[model samples]
Structure formats: structure tokens, C-alpha cells
Target: MFIKIIKRTMTIILIIIGLLVISYLLFTNFYPNFGGDIANEQKEVYQKSKQYKDGKFHNTKPVPKDLSFPETLKLAYTFFTTNVPNGRPKEDLKTKKVDSINIANYQGEARMFWFGHSSFLLQMDSKTILLDPMLGKVAAPHPLLGANRFNKEFPLAIEKLPAIDAVIFSHDHYDHLDYGTILKIKDKTKHFYVPLGLGTHLKKWGVHPDKITELDWWQNTVLDGLNLICTPAQHFSGRKFNTSQSTLWCSWVIKSKTENIYFSGDSGYATHFKEIGEQYGPFDLALMECGQYNQMWSDIHMMPEETAQAGLDVKAKKIMPIHWAGFKLALHAWTDPINRVQAKAQELNITLITPKLGEEIIVKDTTNNYPKWWEKY
Candidate 1:
């Protein structure tokens, strides 16, 4: 009886091991490669497009050596092995509900609050623009793949979001744009601004064609005294299989009559910042990308110091590092990026604002004064 029991136990253990091996192989092979070929092709076409033709891809800034795949994977594995710390969810914060911004009050002023990660609500003049809103809990299509979103939830649910004059999508990356959020907020949006091919995903997700305005790099669009200029970024994009660079990735310069705001959608160290600054700089504010960076993907995401430098490159008066404290896209400690950014910004003497998820930082006409809001967290 003992021998028989041992045989059965061995059989079950073997089965489990076999299943584990199969699952890893499946994810490593099929899952990662699912849309890979299409993405590769899209990249080829994107490279040949006018944006590339105009020398946008030619200029670049020096990046660190660590942003390679091997290093990125190693760091990611190490990050997963270590436990991540927690912070107060934005929902728990006693934030001021932006029910109705007296456009009259802050007239000629600008205000921006990062909901989390790439989700930023900007109020410039009387227009409210939401940038790459990924307010959902999971940054993945399904909840299992991505880490849980850090904030309690966006201060307001997507359906409950106030009227958005424009929804600017940086790319199709899950962390940048949320499908469900768009579905809910679509009706309230008058225009959906995105890069060349990103509109395809928005359309697939139910946003109307007429509502979508696709722009290549250096393209400019005007709406209600706001000039939206799409500039290039060193990055890639895709939502599913076969569509990698079919769309463009970019930063944006939001210039109203008096205020200049730049959103570094997602980028590596690039010379475009200086060019962008020359074209539309001396900006009052720059919502630069500063999180989810690993040495492996350094070509795409900016490191903490790189982010601050980019702010200076663009000649921004104030820098509010966005892209951190929301999702664990990289293995680093949750607060490490912001901590590093603060240090770097201080060294550079660049003004940095660390607002809570829902806390609004109003750029007043007189000057930009931000309290140390992230101190408690």
C-alpha cells in the first residue's frame, strides 16, 4: 500500500511540473510573439513616414547603456522577487473635487493634476484636456498580467468625468490609454487627438472616426486659443498582434495665448527636446515622463535624471514628473523614481511639483508655487 501511494504521488508531481513548464513556454513564446510580426512591419513603415523624413528620428540625446533587453529582464525579475511597498490610494485623499473650475477665476492661468501614470487632466484657458487616460485598476487588457494600479481609483470615475474638450492619446500602450475609460468618456469628448495610426485602436474600441484627429510629428492643430503641437518621441507602440509602429509616438506642446505646457508622452533621451524648446519653449510647465524606467528599456522611457534634463532641455519653468506612483511597469521600488527625480531636479534647480493623485496644482498668473504634496506618501 505504501509503494502504491508513493507512485501516485510521483505521478501527480510530474504532472504539475509538466504543466508549469508548458505555461512558461507558452507565455515566453506565443504570448510575447502574438502580435510581434505585425508590430515589426508597422515600425518599418513608420520609419519611412514624413515624420522620420523631416529628421525627427535623426536627432537624439545620449542615453545610458543599461536599457537593453537582458538588463531590463534581469532587473524586472529582481524587482518581482522583492516585495513592493504600498501608499495611500488617491481615492482616500481629501482632494478638492474639480466640480467647476471658475475658468473666470484662473482665466489666463493653467492647472494640471495627474490622476496617475499617464493620466493627466489639464485645464488651460477654458479647455479641459485629458492626456492618455489609463485610470483603470489594471494596465493590461486583463487584470492578471499587469500590476494593480496604485491610486485608490481616479478621484472621479470615467463616466462621471467632467466634459473633456479633447482627449490626447500618446500611443496604444496599455498604460497610456485605457479602452474602457475611453468608451465611458467618449461621449463627453469633442475631439480625440492621437498619433498617426493610434486612431485605429480608438476606432476598434468604439471611438468614432470623425471624433479622432490623427497627427504626425510636427503637426499643429488649433482649438479655442489652444495650439496643440505633436512632436516626436523615441518610443514604440502597439495594442495587439501585427501593429507595432503603425502609429507614431510623441510628446506635445500645449501653447495657449500666454501659457506653454509640454507633455513628454513617453520618450528616451532625445535631442528633440532642444528643438521643441526652441520652437515652443520657455514653457510655464512640463509634465514630463519620469517613471517605469529600466536600463533595458531606457531607449523608450527616461530615467529620473533624464526626465529633469528633458524639462530643462525644453526650457520649462516648472517640471511635474508624471508616470510614476501608479503602476509597477518596472521592478524598481515604487518611490525610487520620484525620490531620484527630486534629487536631480534640486541639483538642476528646476522647479518640481509632487502633487497627490487628485490634488490640483494651479499655475497662477503671478508665479508657479507648489507645496510639497508628496511628502506624506
Candidate 2:
């Protein structure tokens, strides 16, 4: 009887293990590729970059050493279990809608529309530019796996939007580079500007090769009389479990004859900010990352205080905090980021603009009309 009982227990354990293996295989296989493999031509381009080494890209400044297996497990455990208050709002966030006519009618004046988080519709120099546009309902591999966007609907539907002159990508992370959003807008988008090794992803998604332009850090291109330069950021990149830092990550400097704009694509507080300021200072506006930060990975994402300082470092005439009020990617309350950064900006006497989602802010308008929209929630 004892022998029979032991045999049954061992058989049950084996069957359970087999089932788990099958489940994992199915999940990975069926899920989107996120991006496909790097082609030989792209690989040749990557080889020319000074940052590419061994088989992956490296940050200008090194990140904290890789976490030990036990440490990584602990971090994962904490992330899965922690419940952050106000991490998500109880109701859909209020947003203003702009029709396509107004967007296309703007003659030569610079205007910007925020779509929450890091996505923005920037019209400057008579060109329409979309930045880090992840317009999907969820910021994850699948809708069921991650947090939903704060708003149920965007200010304008993708189909109704005016033709896009350019779509600028900061990196390949899911929140910033969404597959569903790209598929919906690709036909209408005229050009795509991405970091090194990222064109492969676009190619896999059916974007024509002629429309894609890949840039390494410090590289600049002239697009419709605007100078679009890829700058450095202290961050990592990967869409899947095993491919971290395979592609470069970057901030952007968009300079025209009349205006200079800096978009701080997700970054930790680093000296690169000062370097950028020296190279391209006194920006008309700087969109700095200010949310989804934790101490464990502080090297990759800046704290609120650091975000304010980054604005100063970039010599921005006006600063606007972004990368918050959209998704709950970290442990802090959803409101914590804006609140803290606003306080710091006030202390530093820095000019900060806190626009409501979907609200259009004329680049030349320096007046403070933005309300504390997040406080009511």
C-alpha cells in the first residue's frame, strides 16, 4: 500500500509539470512577435554604432549591475503582490476632443496635443509629428495581461486623424511602441523615425522600408526643413523576456528655424541632460518623463525631483511633465508623480506646464490656464 501511494504521488507531479510546460509554450507561440529578428542589412547598420557591443546595445552610462536570480525573483514577487492606492482612477479620465479640420487648418503656428502619458501630436514648422504614440486600450502584450489605459477612448480616433508626416518612436517598450496602434495608423503615416535596430520591428509589422529611417545617438536628419536629432538616454529596451537592450534607446531633439523642442524619452537622471542642454539649449518646450519610477530601478527612470532638475539641465524655457496619468506601471499613487514634480518645479522657479489630456496648448502661449485636473479624482 505504501509503495502504491508513493507511485501515485510521483505520477501526479510529473503530469502537472508537463501541463505547465505546454501552457507556457502555447502562450509564447501564439502571442505577437512584438518585433521580428534583425535583418542582415539592419545588423550591418547596427555594427557601425559605437554603443553596440558583443550582441546588445549599451547605455552611455552603465546601469546598476544585473540583479541576482534571488533578487530578481524577490522583485517580481513584490511587483505582483503590491497594491497601490489610487494607482488607477475610479472613473475614466476627462479629455477634450479636437476635430481633424482644426488640426489641419493651423497654418504655421506651433501647436501640441497631449494624448496622455508620453504620446503627443506636435505640429510645428508646417509639419505634423506624432511622438511615442501608444494609442491602444492596454499597455501590455495582451489586453488581459496588463493595466488598461486611463481613458476608454482617445480624443480622436486614428481613422479620423489628419495624415501624419512623421511618427517618432523613443524605444521599443510596449507602452511606447504598441503593435495594435502601429497597425491602425501605418497606412496613413508617411514616415517613421526610430532608434538603431528598431527598423526590423517596423519591417515585420508591414511598414515599407522606404518610409523607415533609423538613427543612432547624436545622429541628425533634416526632415521638411526640421532637424530631427536622436539624443542619448539612460534606459534599457526589450519586448520579450530574453532580449533586453538589443536595440538602442534615445531622447529626441526637434529643431526648426523658429522653435526647438526636446522630448525626454524615458530616462533616468543622467549627465546626458546637461550635455544635451549645452548642445541644444533654451528649448521652447521640453517634455520630460516624470512617472513610473521606483527606487529598485532608479537608474533607468528618474524620480520627480530629478525630472524637474532635468528640465533645468536641458535649459528648457518651459517644461511639461509626462510619462504619468496614463498607466500604472509602478508602485506610487497615480497622482504622486505630478504632485511631487509640481512642488519641485515651484521651488526651483522653473516654468512648468501641466496640460490636461487631449488639451491643445499653443507652443507660444505661456499663460497658466491648466487646472489641477487630477485632484478631483
Candidate 3:
């Protein structure tokens, strides 16, 4: 009887384990948001990249992709149990409405519209380009898994946007490369430029392989005389647990005839910034990452102080902070990133642009005072 009881217990345990394994596999594989697997052909492209090795991409400097499982559990416990002061805005963020007619009729010079977080619509040289356009309401692969964006609306609805000449992606992270946004804009976008292996996700998401152009670090392509260079960034990428760093991650240098702009997709502070600055210095503007960061993950995400230094390292004449005011991905207060970045920028005497969502940020105009908008919320 005791033997039989032990057998039954073992059977129950085995069944639960089997069920969990099945659930995990089903969610990671069947869910479209978990993203695409790297094909052998894409592997060939990745193999040639200096950053790729042992079936994965590695940061130029070694860094933890995420905390250990035990640490993650502990962190999760603290995150929910402890109250973070103003971790999210008490009120919905206010934003400007973008006129699609103005966008379609845009002329004269480059202009940018922030859709909060790292999403931006950049029009330059008679072309419309999207930089990390994660315009979705949530950052997770599924709605139930992530926090809602602080803003109730965007500068312009994604469905109402004008024709897009190109879309540039920094990596395949859910927040930066949203699946839903891709579905909405894929047919409208003429071309997609991404780092190596990221094309696999776009291709799987119904973006024709021809429309996707994947570049290795330091590789560059010109779009109607605009130079788009994929440069090194110290970060990791993985939509699913097992696929971390299977794709490349990097910053970008988008240079037009008269303007050079650097978009730091997601990176920690590193020597790569100096190298990028030396290679492509004197940028007219830089959009730097300055949110969803913590000391425990400092090796992967830059502290607010490091963000200002990175701007200087990239030799940006004017800098704007991004990767905040969209979602609360870290333990810090929602406003902490901008405040800290602002303080550092002031001390360093770096010109900082803090534009409201949907406000027009003219590329060459440095004197326009963007209001301290976040303070209002």
C-alpha cells in the first residue's frame, strides 16, 4: 500500500512537470509575439559577424543578459511588495497631435516626433523613417504580461500615419520592435533596416525578405543619400528565454547631407561610444536611452549619469533622452530617469531636448525650448 501511495505521488509530480513543460513550449513557440527562430541562411549571415559566436551574439563587453532565476524571483517579490514612489504618473500623460498632412507635406529640413519611450518618426531629405517604433500600448509579447503605457494616446495614431520610406530597428526586444506595430505598418513601409538576425523576426511577421535589409555591426547602407550605419552597442537581445543574444543589437548613425543623428537603441556605458564618436562624430542630435534601468542591471542598461556622458562621447551637439515615459520597466520612479539625465546634462553643459509626445522637434533648430512637460504629470 505504501509503495502504491509513493507511485501515485511520483505520477502526480511527473504529470505536473510535463504540463508545465508543454505550456512553456506552447507559449514560446506558438505565440507570434515570442518571435521567429533564426534560420540556417540567417545563421550564415550571423556567422560572419564578429559579435556572433557559439550560436549566439555577444556584447563587445561581457554582461549578464538578466539576473539569475533566484535573483529574478527575489526582485519580483520586492517589486510587488514594496511601493515605488511615483513609479508611474498619477495622471495620463498629455501629448500633441501630429498632423499627417504636415508630415506628407514636410519639406525644408529634418523633423522628429516622439511617440514616447524610444519610438520616433523622423522625416528627413524628403523621406519618412521610423526609429524603434514600438507604438503598442504594452511592452510585453502579451497584454497580460506587461504594464500599460503612461499615455492614453500617441502624437499620431499608427494607423493614420503617412507612407513610410523605411523603418530602422535597433534590436528585437519587445519594447523596441513591437510585433503589433509591424503588422500595422509592414505593408505601408517601403523598406526595413535592422541589425543581423533581426530580419528573421520581420520576415516571419509577414515582412517580405526583400523589404528587410539586415546589417552587421559597422555595416552601412544609404537610403536616398541618407547614410544608415549600424554601430556597436553594449546590450543583449532575446524575446524568449532560450534565444537570448541569438540576434545582434546596436546603436545607429543616421546621417543626411546636412545632419548626423545618433540613435542609441539600448546600451550600457562602454568604450563603443567613444569608437562610434571617433568614427561618426559631431552629430547634430542624439536620441539616448535613459530609462528602465537599475544598478543590478547596470551592466546592460546605462545609468542616467552615463547617458549624458554617452552623448558627449558620441559628440552630439544636442541630446534628447528616450526609453522613458512610456512604461515602467524598472524600480526607479518614472520621472527619475529624465530628472537625473537633465541634471547631468546641465552640469556637462550639453544641450538637452525634452519634447512632449507628438511635439515637432526640428532637427537643426537648437534654441526652441521644449517645456518641462513631465513635471506637469
**Candidate 2 on 1-377: residue-level lDDT in tens?**
99999999999999999998887667655666467666566667688898987778898777855677689889878877998888888798988998889887767678899999999999998899899998988888888878788987777777788899999999999889998888988999999999997877888889999999989999999998999999999998888655678888999999989888999999999999999999998898999999999998999999999999999999988899999988989999999999999999999999899988888878777787688989887
The TM-score values for the models, in the order shown, are 0.78, 0.94, 0.96
Clash counts for the predictions, in order: 9, 0, 0
| Best-performing candidate as measured by lDDT | 3
Clashes of 3: 0
The predicted structure with the larger lDDT, 2 or 3, is: 3
**Candidate models: Cα lDDT each:** 0.74, 0.89, 0.91
Write one digit per residue (lDDT tens) for candidate 3, span 180-232: 99999999999999999898898888999999998989999999899999999
Model 3 Cα RMSD, Å? 1.5
Which candidate should be chosen as best, given TM-score against the real structure?
3
lDDT computed for candidate 3: 0.91
Residue clash pairs of candidate 3 = none
Question: What local lDDT does model 3 show for residue 204?
Answer: 83
Instruction: Give candidate 2 regions above 4 Å deviation.
Output: 1-26, 68-70
What would the per-residue lDDT of candidate 1 be over residues 178-290, giving only the tens digit for each residue?
76677788888899888876776677666778998878889999987789999988787665423444456888888888788888888888888898999888988888999
The window of 10 residues in a row where model 2 has the poorest summed lDDT is: 28-37
Model 3 earns a TM-score of 0.96
Native-to-model Cα distance after best TM-score fit, residue 125 in candidate 1, in Å:
2.9
> Residue 348 of model 3: what lDDT?
98
